[model samples]
Target: MTKFNTTAGKPPIVVSDEDYGRLTKLATAALDRFPDVAEELQIEMERAQVLSTATIPEGVVQMGSTVEYHSDVEQRRRITLVYPGEADIAEGRVSILTPIGAALIGLSAGQSIRWVSRDGREHVLTVLKVEQPVASATPTVV
Candidate 1:
């Protein structure tokens, strides 16, 4: 099996501590049902540079961030990284448990990574843009 590579010299990835904690639990629970994906998620978490949610860079691909990426075969795609429950392919929402989603987490704009899909095909994805979710303002009671 030709596994994904995070070999030396690749660009570093930054993940928020909140995301890390939640994703860790998700991966652990998926170990029995989705071993390959769980393993990949674990590997990503192992190499991630974890930061606090407030400290994470705006351009980094975090959960719920909308990202525009260029793939070697698929060309350009705009996808929102979301948890499994919120994933909807028709709406361009990708699940964190999927191959592409697992590969995209923590990556920053302008970084490119090569990952193999479930069908054993390798694809190179380059992040073109990252749109972080806007923080909701606190409601004030008059």
Candidate 2:
């Protein structure tokens, strides 16, 4: 809680049409509990270029994508962006509802974004790589 930053003319973002509907619901439902982030996510979606899953080009950051990026606060991070239900920071899974996760959405390799942390510090991150989840990344059981 109490995370996220204000960006400068946020770069355009994209979302799978399939995910948009569910994400809309998520943002609306979270309004009561996590207003700031939920609202941030909602605002992102408002401008997102939603396309069919099949039309979504590779390397675009989508749900379940394992992205490698460098941020000002950290040297670099490689994590999978997941739905809130599946987020387990310990396992390198980040929820879409979190600040960083929300920022990572729709970004592709070589794209950078700037944001201000709660303490009024401005930070920038560049996406180095994006790997969409494969069937192997999902295992029904151990």
Candidate 3:
């Protein structure tokens, strides 16, 4: 089992070992171009329960997962979480480097996160569903 550093007083988050490594490098690389979002992602990772994908709990969000979330500032939306290179707002493919993307990473269905948007507006977002892409490398969570 994995553990979260609750001493940080934040909600628990999970991350696959593979995602952790890649996202860490991604965060570092995005520092110059996306400092705020990158820093937010770094903080989420610091409190994450790092594990292998097979052991990732059912409903947990990960790379390539399609997430259904509700926000205090906007209507409910569904989006596929993807790497920055794959992001297309028109296609509902969101980048994990964006504020909402960084906020959604590692969250499970029913989990809610409070974060600030790029425009400096604070928002609360809740994950209503998580669908791992059928073509993903990791086994799908039930």
Candidate 2, residues 34-53, lDDT tens digits: the string is 78778878877887899998
Error of 3 at 69 (Å): 0.9
Relative to the true structure, candidate 3 reaches a TM of: 0.88
Query: Per-model C-alpha lDDT, please?
Result: 0.87, 0.81, 0.84
Name the candidate that leads on lDDT. 1
**Candidate order by TM-score, highest to lowest?**
1, 3, 2
* TM-score versus the correct structure, for each prediction: 0.90, 0.86, 0.88
Please report how far candidate 1 places residue 127 from its true position, in Å: 0.1
Question: Is 2 or 3 the stronger prediction by TM-score?
Answer: 3
Error of 2 at 12 (Å): 1.4
Model 1, residue 72: C-alpha shift (Å): 0.8
Per-candidate clashes come to 0, 0, 0
lDDT of 1 by residue, 1-142 (tens): 2566555645689999988988898999999988888888888988999999999988999988999999988779999998888889999999989989999999999999888788888888999999997765852111
Candidate 3's residue-wise lDDT over 11-122, tens digit each? 6899999789889889998989988888888888887899997898879999889999999977899999989988999999999998889888999999888777777777
Better of 1 and 3 by TM-score: 1
Clashes of 2: 0
Q: How close is candidate 2 to the true structure, as a TM-score?
A: 0.86
| Per-residue lDDT of 78 in model 1 | 99
Q: Give lDDT: candidate 1, residue 121.
A: 88
